[model samples]
Structures are given as C-alpha cells and as structure tokens.
Target: MTDMPDNIVMPFEIKPLGVRGRIVRLGAVVDDILHKHDYPAPVSALLAEAVALTAMLGASLKFDGKFILQTNSDGPVDLLVADFSSPSGIRGYARFDADMVAALKEPTPQALLGKGHLAMTIDQGQGMERYQGIVALGGVSLTEAALGYFQQSEQIPTRLRLAAGALAQRGLRPEAWRAGAIMVQHLPRDGGISPQPFDSGDAPEGSKEEVTEDDHWVKARLLLDTVEDHELLDPMLTPEELLYRLYHEDGVTVYPAVTLERHCTCSRDKVGDLLKSFSDDDRAHMNSNGVIDVTCEFCSTHYQFAPEEVEPAPEARAQAQ
Candidate 1:
C-alpha cells in the first residue's frame, strides 16, 4: 500500500466548464477522532462521513467563523455532531445505543440514522447573524440530505460524494480510519444558469424567456458522477490525480490546499465553568464522593472538580485566602 499524506482540503476548478469544487482527504486526524470514541464500526463509518462533510463546507468560509453540522434522529444512532473552526480545526462525536447497533445483522449508514433532520449552521463569530438550513432525513443518505439543503436553501446546483472506511496493511488488523469527499458547484460568471425559476410576476407582459440548466454544468456534474468510492479513499491517489482523472478534459486548475488537523476545544477550566453554572443544590447532587467528574464528548477528556472550587468564583476564593 502506498503511503498517504496527512489530511488536507484542496480547492480546484474546471475553469472551462464554469464549475468549482473542493476535495478533502483525511488521514491520521480522522483516525484519531474515530478511535478515540471506540464506536462500533457502523457508527464510526457514519461519523467519519459527517466529519468529511463538515470539513468540506467549513473550508469555504471567507471569514474566521465556525460551521456546525448536527443531526437528530430516531434510530440506533440518535445524534451526530461535528464542527469545523476557521482555517482547519475539526472535531466530531456520535451518540448511539451499543446494543441496538450490535443487534443489527448489517446496517447501512442511512439505516443506522433511521429518520431525522440534518441541520447545518454557520456562526460568523460574535456580533454577526448566523445562517442555518435544515432538511428532513429519511430513506436517503447524508450526502443526499446535504444536496437537498443546498437545493432548497441556497438554490445552487451542487454534486457531492463521500467515502469512509478502515484501511489496514495486507493480512493485518485494521489500523486506521480514513475519509474523503468531493463537492462541485455550478457557478457561471455571466449568470447564465439560475437554479431558481423565472419570476412570472416580475417579467414583462409579452416576454417568454424560460430558464434552463446550463450545458457546462450538466457536463461537469456528469463527470463528477464517474468518481468511485475507492478513488476517494485511495491513499495512493492524490487529490490532484483524482481531479485530473475527472476533469482533465476541461483543464482543472488547483489552488493551494488547506491542511487540516483534529482539535477539541475542551478544557478543565471550561468544564469547571460549566459546573459552576449549575445551582447550589444541583452541584451538591453532582458531588459524588467529594468530586465531580466531567468528560468531554468530542475529545473524551476527563476533568474533575471540587465542590468548593466551583461554588465561589476563583477570584473570590483568592480574596478569602
């Protein structure tokens, strides 16, 4: 097996076709996040896809902000949360019932998720309005749900493919989890393609211009449809090589890739502050054997705090000292 490079998100465009897209290849970063949770195989696979999707969408932010992808469902896997911070920080976690997962003979990712709604939110930091889109999820994969979101919410013609699995050396135990995704959007410079319908109310009385899909976009999407799951997950093939295979006829131009890493924004101090937010009676019940234990779902970092430490503000305790 060829050695795969570290995680990265590469931006590329088929200029001749008026289409732009991003390709993300995740390696150790994704492996670490999945292994940290020790989730069952099906759950891990689903979460990995969510991570890849989150990274692809978050990388498009022009400002220093955050993009969050969350899903609430009525399946074995009840919830999935993944967020990407500005530039290249990504973290994710999944909530599932182990017994229900194990009881399944074989479960596809969509089956594991059952029925739910997927929500994507963008936070432009403090003092800025947030934008969010929600789409119902059932009888479809997460990729399809995301496409529906873009179609209904952004009204943009988009195509996306995602893959994730455990890769191991020949005749050995599975060592790592990897995920990859590619997304393409139709964006014509001359505004030739409008996904929205023509507004008859605003049109001139005698005008009869009807909107239709652009040929370039149709060709670009057809080309993207040729991508295979193995190609996306193949460590041997670089993102550039994959893009060439798909868009070489149209001459693909690539921009600098954005390196990504796994990072959790959890800390002892933060957990302590969270504990202090509870009322005195609540804190009392939480003080089990003289200490309260908190574990971060994203990173699985464990923290412990004393009751008195959280009761009074640190500054007030210092004054009393």
Candidate 2:
C-alpha cells in the first residue's frame, strides 16, 4: 500500500484576527455513506453537502467531543445526520422511498428536504453540558438552512457552499463519488465578545461615523455575495486557490486539511441492544427461525448474529459480575 497522510485533526487558525478554526475534507468517508442506500441523485447530493457542512461547523467546537448536524424533514427525503470530530468522519443515509429514481430532476435543497428542522448538537465529551441549537429551516437547500442557523441562532457571520455528484465523466451512479465544499466566516474583528462595529454607519452617508462598524459589515457582506456556487463546488479547483480567489486581499489564513473517513457507531451487539427496546414479541419475531443479519443503513456494513447470540443481557448476572 502507498503511504497515507495521517488524518489527524489539526485545527487551523486565523493569525491576524486571533480567530481559530478547523476544516475536515470528506472523500472516502462520503462514498461509504452513499453506498448505504440507493438514494435519488438529488437526495444523495443533499447528504453530501450535509456531510461537509456538519464537519465544517463541528470543527469549530472548542472541546473534545462530537458535533452532530441533523436534518429531519417530513418530505420524501427525510433524515440526514452527519458526525464530526477529531477522527472527523461522515456516515449517514437518506430516507428515500423505494420507488425513488436517480433520473429525476435535481431539486433545490429546501424542495428536496421539504418542511423540516435543522438541529446542531454539541457534545463536549466531559461532564460539561451538551448544547443544541434548533432553527426553522429556511432557504432553497441545505446551504441556505445552514446560513439561517448561523445567523439566527449562533449569530456567527458564516457563508457556506457545497455540491456533490459523481465525477463528470464517471456518470452519476459511480462507486466512487466526489463531493466538495467551502466554508467562510468573518473572524471576530473586535473581539470574541466585542460589541457590534457597524451600529450607525448610516449617518446621512457623509457623517464621520458613516465609516462605522456597519460599513465594515456591509463591505464584508458584499464581498461574500460575489462567491458563486460553482467556485465552491468545483472539484477541479484546489481549496487554497479557491480561498485566495475569494479572500486574497482580505487576509485568509489557510489551515492544514483533515481527511474525512467512513465510520459508523453501529454494531451487531449494539443493534441487539437497541432491539431490547422492543417488546419480547418483537424480538422473538426478529429471531424466530435463524440468524438475523443487519446491514447498517449508514455504511452498508453487514452484520449477522445467530439467534442464540441475540439473548438479552442478564440483569442478575450484570449485578453479580
């Protein structure tokens, strides 16, 4: 096997503003997620974007833990979950109907997701309190909803664009998929908790304070407004070059990349444990005749445990042991 760079989570920092961050690029991991199911083209694309966005946001977590971004909707494409952290990874499946087809017209994010809630969950690993932010979904796709979440809930100034599909010449159903994304956020210019800068820049357009924080904010906003989806999503452009193109003069600090892999928290024993949540009748039915095989919907990993191996944990033995 050829050498592989260590996929360690090396956090990237903005030197000038003293603002720090991290970015996880998804590749091998994304394919594993997509292989879990035969999702419609549009649905798969949404999950890919979800993977990048979640990793991007999760990298900003300050402590050792996992950040989960979940999209739960009442639409045809129902659920999307992305897990992110040091061993930063992505594995998730969409709830596409059996009749779904890949040949359908592509959909805007909101249309594909339908009415839903976007929730960001932060688990700090230690005894620290876990935090969650839930915002009403907005915008045409996952990118738009994420933008709304950042602005309305976290109040952090952020911009994100993502795209997912097979390599152009490879066709849409290729075993290897390519997904790309770019994330940008305005560093805390004043300070992490400093007061807003652009409060009164609207002073008659001629007042000295017209160059207030508002003016700076306006300028920043205008700069981001010029970014196109193609630039962020294109696989041909290198990530650093993409940044230079967007913020060359604005002083963006490039950080080392973290490799995103395919990992899932599912196991046969774990699945059995979950089965314990069901009634005995259900469990009996599940293992009535022979082995019950489980293929995780996230990574398509197949697991089989014979009926004899599916027994419930013994409460008394647990206490004694």
Candidate 3:
C-alpha cells in the first residue's frame, strides 16, 4: 500500500569504504505478527528483532528460496522462529515460558535467551540443497552472534545493529510493535577480506597472532556503532535519510528497495496433510469431541476438520465399516 511504505529492505553500498549493506524497517507488518500472539513485551521485542534480521538476510538470496532464523536456548524465552520467503513474505513467532519470564530479575537479551545456539538456514525449495550455519549464544547479543556466524561460517567481516519497540502517538493511536536492522559486510576490491581469528585459550603459547582490520572497515564500523536504537526504529526517518546520515561522507549509493508484507504459508489443506501424517494414536489423541482443531502458530488461524477429512482413505473406510 502506498500509505504504508515503511516495510521495505533497501540495499546499499559505500564504494569508497568497500562495504555493502542492507537496511530493513518493518512497521505494520511486524505489528501484525506480534499481535497475533499475546506474547509478553520482552518476547515480542525479541521476536521483532529476529524478524527484522531475517528480512535483511533473506533479501540477499539470489534465488527463490526461504531464509529461516531460529534460536534454541535454556532461558525463559527458549525458542524463536522467523522465516522469510522469497519475493517478500515474512512471518515469525516466539515461544516462551511466561512464568519464567516474569520471574527474571532483568529481562536482558542474555537472560531471555540464556546459553543456546542461533541457527540460520537457507532452503532453496524442494530438490535443492539447504544450507545452515549455527553460532553459539554464550555471553553475546543477537547482533554479535550473527556477526560471529558470518565471521566463522562465511569468513566475512560484518557489523549489524537491531532494534525493536512499541511506538505510539501520545493521543492519536495505541502502541504498535516496530523493528529495524542494518547490516554491513566488508567487500574490498581485493576479493574478500578474512576476519580475524578468535583467540582459543587452549592454543599452545605463542600460537596467537594479532590481525589488524583494514582502515576503511574500521571507519565504516565506527560509523555503524554511532547509530542509536531510536534512529533505527523511527518511522519518520526514511531509509535514504538514515543512510545519508550514516554514510554521506563516503557517498552511499542505494538501489531500489524491495517491499515486504506479512504472509503466512499455513493453509487448511497443508494442516490437514500434516495431521494425516501423524500416527493413528497421535491423531486420536489430538481429536476433541467430533472434530480436530488446528491452530497455526504463525498467524493464529484456527481450522476444524472432521475425523474423516484428515484420515487416510483406507483408515476412514475401515472405521466406517
């Protein structure tokens, strides 16, 4: 909709600094996803960040595929799943123990996710190979974890920032969840730059070496660090304006932006097929009264199926007989 231009991913490059980047901002699209589940504020915020990051990474796919971002941890908020389908569909949901979340002393990102791993998966449709990269979440923010994924898995020097919160006008409207993210990767003319290696404390003494970052990358990273949470989440600020504010000194070039929307892939037929895949015992356990109720986690859509509707033809015939 022309009235809602906030949901978009803009790709850009800073030629002088040899850095390529993407900026993702979600307004109504994220709000709808968050509203579908009455999750706690902290959980919603985390999910918002996950969704924004998914969009940024998914937009880079050169083919028609899906990008999935998931986290499994031992914290109050244990699981988060967000997926971006090619051509601009994004949806995500979060799972958490409300009681555990309420018991937290401070709902910091670390406290919410505890010690777990973050996984980034790329699915290039059926028959195509799926690629996944995982990074440990110990003692690091989500942004840092993603950076580590790129550093170790892709060996690319990367910097990222993510922010999400509820924004509202004082009197006109209620608060709505919004998210924004910016990521930059070094792409020097010399092919690709290797990221510095981690210092393994177990390494034999003197095996450690100091690796210096390129000056241009250092400048770009410093500029990225200067970004504030509000600057990223501000609906009033266009992506172009923010890019100019961040990299006008080096001359930033932006390509056409890709629009994003809230789209759930779940359908009645799909759910029915999934239910039918379960064993008879499983399906019997799931049955309630005379119907089977199904709720989509992503969109909170509810569907009801008659027993015969989801049962295999042989099983249905046997039962009828």
Candidate 4:
C-alpha cells in the first residue's frame, strides 16, 4: 500500500486480464455527514454503505458531473440518498421511522427497505442528457443489490464488499465512524480464446489448458471473496496493501488514487435563488417570525433569509431584461 492518508479511492487492474477494481476507505468525511443527523445504529449503517457505494461508483465514471444513488420503500426506512459530485465529494442521508426501527433487535437492508427499487443516476451537466438505471432490490445486502444491478442492466460481472462501523479508541471522547468498500469488475475482451491451464494452483481440479471467459471471471470472484470485512474497514490497511493482499497472486497494478471529501452544494445563495422563484405572496406565507429558515437535509446546514432578500430588487429585475 502506498503511504498516504485515508478517504481515497485507489484504482487497480489485474495484469494480462480484462479486470479492474477500486478500493475506497472513508474516515472523517463519512463521520462528518452521519454526525449531522441522529440516526439509529441500523439506519446509520445503511447510510454508510450508501455513501461508500456512491464513492466507488462515482470514481469509476469519467464524467465531470454528479452521480446519485437512491432508494424509496414502504418499510421503516422510507428514503435513502447518496450523491457524489465530480472530482471527489460525497454526502448521504436517510429517513426512517424511529419507533419501528427501535423495536427491532437488528435490521437488515432488506428489512429496512422492504420492497423497493435501487436507482442510479448520472448527470453530465447542461446540454447533456442524464442517464438513469433502476433495478428491483432483491438482495439481502446493499452490495448484493448493486451486483445484481450490474448483472441485469450492464451484463457485467461485478463483485462488491462493503463494511461500516464505529471505531472506539482509548482517549477519544466519542467513537469515530468509518465506511469502506472494494469493487471488482470484469471487462469484455475482444475475440474468443481457448481455455488456458491454471498455474496458480487455486483453479478447479482437472481444468483444461484452454481457459474460457467464465473461468477467468470465476477466479476473479473467488479471489474477491477472500477479502474479509475487517481488512476493508481497517484504517491501518492501505489500498495498495489491501489490493496486494487480495490479488497479489493474480498480479495487480495500482493506478493513480482519487481523494474524496465531504461537501454539500447547498448554500445561502442557492437557497435564496430557489426562494426567489416564488411570488411575493408565496414568500410572505413561507416566512416564520419575519425570517425564512431553510435547512439542507444532506448536511444540515441552515440558511436564513429575510423576506426582502428573497424578493428581487427593482434594479435587478430591470437589468434582467
């Protein structure tokens, strides 16, 4: 593993094979976002997984825009949202029925989201049409659901392992939360090749010298399964080290890393502009105690605006024409 800080996405490719993967470990950034809301353990865990997924998927894209992952269901967790901005920024939030969640001893992803669909959206800024893919949530964990989406929507062989939890240290006043995930994908190769013999000694017994595509994919998946939950979430484990530990036998090569940060697009000016769309009467009705307070759900940032600030000035309106 390269010597660097956490909160980064490291890309790697298996040499001589059409396979690619990424490892992401998030620390302070995830802790910052989750701390804004008072969520139960189950809800917090789900949201952390969402955030990690967002970072992994977003980093894989080459677009300079935004990627969003969301789920809506009738279960205790009504909504889960995570968005990643271009370059490297991620934020996530969840809404759940407190009483219902509290009643359960342990809640799984499927239980929290009883019946719902997972949606992924990519927005490439103005003049470009946004793309979205939806798949039914059939898996028990978020990682499985994501793998299902890749299989059904893109027909790509993919594997993902995600883990999140609070880390307790001796002198820390409060436990620090962290989330991490690793993803591996098999890219299509041109033309067909004979089934090649395995030299790693990990392949199935009596395998033919000519290896088929399925054989390669199966080998990659098997290697991925060897990764333990602790290895992925441990802050001490660097991405390079983790990848080496998993795919060293397969010959892994690390690419440049992308750093991630916690950021919210919401701001006072943006909120003010949204309120300006309303008429004077509507704006007046929205005011409370002569001030309109808007709180961002993703980051819990509060923006207050006086009625006058929301109303466009005469000079500004005249300049618009």
User: Please, what are the lDDT tens digits per residue for candidate 1 over residues 182-285?
Assistant: 99998877766535444447777878576677788889888899999889998889898999999988899999988999999988788887777777788898
Q: What is the lDDT of residue 96 in candidate 2?
A: 62
In candidate 3, what are the lDDT values of residues 185-236, reduced to their tens digit? 8997678773555675887899887788788898998999999999999988
Q: What is the TM-score of each candidate against the true structure?
A: 0.90, 0.78, 0.93, 0.87
Residue-level lDDT of model 4, residues 212-232, one tens digit each, is 556677778788899888887
Q: Which stretches of candidate 4 lie over 4 Å from their true place?
A: 1-4, 170-173, 188-213, 279-282, 312-321
- Model 3, position 228, has a per-residue lDDT of 92
| Tens digit per residue, CA lDDT, model 2, 91-166 | 6666765343333364667666778798888888878888888877644577777777776676666656666765
In model 2, the Cα lDDT at residue 24 comes to: 37
Please tell me which model should have the higher lDDT, number 2 or number 3: 3
Candidate 1 C-alpha error for residue 270, in Å: 1.0
| Cα-lDDT of candidate 4 | 0.83
Model 3 ranges off by over 4 Å = 1-4, 170-173, 194-203, 315-321
- lDDT (Cα, 0-100) at 25 in candidate 3: 90
Top-scoring candidate (lDDT)? 3
Model 2: worst 10 consecutive residues (lDDT sum): 2-11
Shift in Å, residue 22, candidate 4 = 0.8
